[model samples]
Target chain A: MKKSLLFLVVTVFILSMVLSACGSGNTNGSNEGKANETATNQPNADKPKDKVTINLVAFAQPHEQKMYTQLIKKYQEKYPHVKVNYITTPPADYATKLQAMIAGGQTPDVFYASPENVSFMVDTDQLLDLTPYIEKSDIFNVDNVWQKGISKYTRDGKTYALPKDVGPFAYVYNKSLFEKAGIPTPDPKKPLTWDEYISIAKKLTLDDKGNNPESPDFNPKKIKQYGAGFWWHEPAVWGNGADYINEDGTKVTIDDPKFIESLQFVADLRNKHHVVPSSEDESSMGGYTRWLNGTVAMFPMGPWDTAAFWDLKFDYDLMPWPSNNGTWGTWLGSQGFGVSAKTKNPQEAFDLAAFLSVDPDIQREAMTMGLQVPNLIDMAKNDYLNMTDKKPVSKQVFLDVIETNGHDWAFEKTYDREWYDLFNSSVTQVWDGKKTPEAFVKELQPKMQELVDKSIEKKKKAQAQK
Target chain B: MQLTEKKKEMWIAYLFILPLLLQFALFTVGPMIFSGIMSFTDWNIVQKASFVGFDNYKNLFQDEKFWKSLYNTVYYMIGIPVGLILAMLLAIGLNRPIKGSKAFRVIFYMPAVCSLAAVAILWQWLLNKDYGLINYALSWFGIEGPSWLGNETWIKAGLIIMMVWKGVGASSIFYLAGLQNVPKSLYEAAEIDGAGKFGMFRHITFPLLTPMTFFLVITGLIGGFQLFVEVVIMASNGGDGPNNSAVTLVVYMFQKAFNYYEMGYASAMAWVLGIIMFIITFIQFKFQDKWVHE
Candidate 1:
């Protein structure tokens, strides 16, 4: 009797375990159904009654979190019903983790979105379309947002995220280094041409002997610090107008003469002119350290360096990159917000996205906190350029671009990775003097064509489905 | 006839084994099969996987960067074995009934317990070209040091050197234990036969240490391939810096799946690596019988 009773209990326990395994899946399905039903029927629900938990993902880690949390706190205060939980990820693993979350249908209501991300999710029907929510919002400026960020974020006339910052280029110079070298600073009145800039770099070049400029017998080998940095970088390619992809986002122009010339120009600063360290030196000590230590005199960087230099206690001035070929150019980058399509409340998610981006206070706060250049054009012109309390470098870069010619930053989700890799590889050979510009271009054409062909086919398929 | 005593015994054995079998299937076997399947598809986090067949494998054939990674792994594998041998020799030297042998063993074994990840950070600075300990020493020799990890030619060698310094001690301890296991009678018998030191090592000590050598070699090879943490902490950048010299296959797999979000491609690369490893191990076992005695 005891053995029989024990067997019954054991069998029942095993049965329950098996049933529980199956039961969880059904429970999730029913829970999703209940949520969807609640969302559909809850138009008249009071503000504080429907508590929403939005996941906020950012590419920038602990650094961005410090400032972004303050922004989130302010938002929570405004809408007491909404609570945002910020999930910070390392820049290296951001895309992979975000992808997993989307696939698992544990998608964040709002996440760090740009043309580089979220679009792939959107195409896969994993991101919610924000068009209706964006239109409904009173504070959202549709035209200004589109004019600023549409190039990078739009797919078949639908905008995914609003612009967050201007990641445009600037030429930052050391006032102390120039003064110490007893060399005249480059003219702030007129943008230095390539020839003039080289002359300035030469003048600023000094041996440890206090011999300012080369005395014609200057020992390049014994030089204390090179006058300029000639590191292999992306801005050099952009300055010379090397387009990685065409308007259709399905072509490569890396081997173009202008691009090849730009790489050669930088490489020559080390190899030929001896004004900079060799490729080995460039590799060993990256440009940022050299620039910081005053070893490299005038360097090219983005507006983000303004905050970096501001805290360094060194006298510095930021200038727009000089015309390498009579074109005033800088690379602009746009970052914005994205919504998950897999969310039970697409409308609610879209509402959160609009509030995060379309809020002018949030945009200005992001700019002040050094997150990015303000996305609003009028605001950038009036407020960002004319802020008296902060440093003037931010104003100068934007004002120069606005007055000269507007450059919008780009972000492509799928196509840029292959194209960027091709450009970097092809130009590296030319920079090393292993391959001629003509050969490099010719070699790249077929490979670029194949990748672009694939991209276009994918885009066309996406268009047809839409 | 339907259920004999032996059959019933086997069934009872299976009943006892079922929990472990289920756990293994759930954790190990399931993931292994899924990973192999993932290798054949194109997966990112957001999208459903699509079958890419052999495109990833084909691309790896053309990837110069992948080849560089293979070079780095191979370089590490080559160095670790030679280093372990030298360390074993060092172990043999310390095993003598000389003064302070205990102290020497502990001193050498200290690095075995020291964190490779922690030491690599300091080693990175010491190996720095412009302001590093190695260059300062090289200056005395009238030889200017090349940028160790920053130079393409020296980067793999640099990583190999770092790994060897950290790993050799643990192998030395294993050899020391093996040395302990060598029966005293064998050495005494050699001495009675008037066999000198060289012959004593060759005939008795060396031949007897083969099993320990085999164990260390296997562990060394496997450990060498999966080395990622020290390299990551040392380089301070992804695998692309310094002419892609520091790139390794595991690092490549990691970046492809996690960084680039090409999980399917990474999974494909991972499976090919697994197959290569399995073949190499099988060959090692097949050929090992000739040299290794029961």
Candidate 2:
């Protein structure tokens, strides 16, 4: 018993010693608080500016964070007078920690701000007015950004933030598959009219033709080959110009005539049209694998899906999202460089933001990953598409989607969160087939209006106190 | 007789455990006081917590999610107690003076040290619908297995099975310790009297192990209520666990505080859970007064 107790004591001692070493090894090892006196002194005679550090917090994945870190390091190298204090937060708990940082009076010098909480920052005047910064750096094209994203960020005609990706849905077909189906290529120039697209889908939908459309024996039900396969929701719903949230980023638009119509169209492709597979079928075969397995001829997705498709080793052709309202629309998402108003040096902060956002190399690397749409026009055409890098993805989709059918997607309004969740929750009712589209929309309208009014009053009171 | 001044001073000195008192005040007492205060207010990381008074507590009472989580906890309480009783029975059986009985003890204790997290995950794999050990074994019996974790009705059963497997060894150890204290003299006395093996066990050995049984039940209930790791990892994103059939209250509190940033609501939840746990332990103690041999 005594020997066992002694062994346990040594074990605990070793465990705690290792834990404490890991505990303090983080911030101190990063040399975060150290002053680079040698480098600061070398340029002292010519430039007497004191070196300053800027804290930046982000909720990006490791690879995405690595890109951001590389940008910061390059910026520090160029502008020796500046140092970057970068903190990579896990995507899950970023908002909680960020809020704590804000309440403590010292937020990151440059950090990611969300559309949902931008109003919170604006309410407290804790965000920098980027108007002047944008004017100074013409390379940061403010006008050419997707209109819908700008609509959400722009409160009372002042933009707050931009995104790295806007979820724009497109029909990616196997050019080889289309050729095998004997469906001549879709007009690359025009994409397709809604009628033309669906008719083509119906025609190319069968390996075991019951007859022909002309022969009155066309059977869509028991087709051996599919004309197109949709991954149920998301791009399909949003592709039809139906949004989850309104343009203001506040209200959910689930019951919108257009939105319900979109769901009906996809559901009809299964139930009514007998074209797309049922939810049960898709549940068994995962979306990525379904297309990769050559079971589906045409797959539907957003520009963000390019990396997944590239990794799957499929020969594919791209088409712009099918049009509904005479003209096609692409919902755009993009990321922006935001300078915290709490920065001790706002001008220096803006200068660093410019250096990071406007740098050709930084924009090039981001564009190569197909992770972000570069805010700059010139640097947007990056060259990492043709690399022998570990996993190289084509940047052409990012460029082409923007060049052809991309449109600014209006973000839903950001106001009362629960009220919005309730509206989004109501979609599950329609999805579960309990409520009709018209009734669901009508039933929830009053709830939405009441919450919107409450939000408006809350914002009014908050502003008045400020 | 009146106590001498030196005698009183020495006795008082014995009561003053300075280092322990200081440690208690700093870590335990300090946190308890702060948590009590926090329970009454909205202490979100953003913006000064405008004191919402009892609003958070009031909302928690009416929330459907809170009630569901409570139901889940009750399910586990019923489950673990029943399983622990079986473990005690097994330990008693294995404690017999038979060949290779020592080997059985080592085998029983092996699971006690195995990480519960790894066990939870491994059991989830075993209970998986398409490609699991349990279902695969069931296939040999020509039996079709249900989606254990995916289905709400089956999730509680799956969690119970995992808990029992992970927990059996620990309870067995406690039973073994209690069984050792059951004197051989009592058994010898019963044998001389022509009382059978069953007679001795029923009257004495079982009664004597009541102290250990009570301890296990109390600690097991407390530990079961704090179930989060398995629910979070195995269940869908939020431990809502498909139809929220497996959402324990503590998991709900974590979701509210961390996921949604409703700290005021979370604090109220934490206090409510603490009160529930206290009441449960109090009831167990009250019952133990009647039944515990020690």
**Leading candidate by DockQ:** 1
Off by over 4 Å in 1: A1-49, A142-146, A180-184, A187-190, A211-213, A230-233, A358-371, A392-394, A399-416, A425-466, B1-24, B43-45, B50-68, B93-120, B227-237, B258-262
Off by over 4 Å in 2: A1-46, A103-106, A124-126, A138-152, A162-232, A236-286, A289-308, A319-337, A379-412, A416-466, B1-32, B76-78, B89-124, B188-206, B243-246
Candidate 1: tens digits of C-alpha lDDT, residues A186-224: 554356666766677777776777454548777776667
lDDT of 1 by residue, B58-121 (tens): 9778876678778777776877677877888988988889999999888877777887767887
Return the DockQ of model 2.
Answer: 0.16
Q: Which ten residues in a row have the lowest lDDT in candidate 1 chain B?
A: B235-244
Best-performing candidate as measured by lDDT: 1
Q: Which CAPRI level is candidate 2?
A: incorrect
Per-prediction TM-score to the true structure, in the order listed: 0.85, 0.75
**Backbone clash numbers for all candidates listed:** 8, 21
Q: What is the i-RMS of every prediction? A: 4.6, 7.7
| lDDT comparing candidate 2 with the true structure | 0.65
Chain B TM-score for the candidates in order: 0.87, 0.89
lDDT of 2 by residue, A1-466 (tens): 6445555755665566556555665544344434444544456666758777777777888777888778878778777878788888887678767776776565777777666666756765667876666666654565655454454456666665554444445567767767876778765445576567677667655536544232356664345555567534444455676776666555557667887787666555555444555433342233456677776667765555656666665467666656565455554444455678767677677766666655667766665665555555544453433443523233445455565555443323544354544454344344434566678777776666655654565555456545
| Residues B138-171 of candidate 2: C-alpha lDDT, one tens digit per residue | 8999998766776657778878877887778778
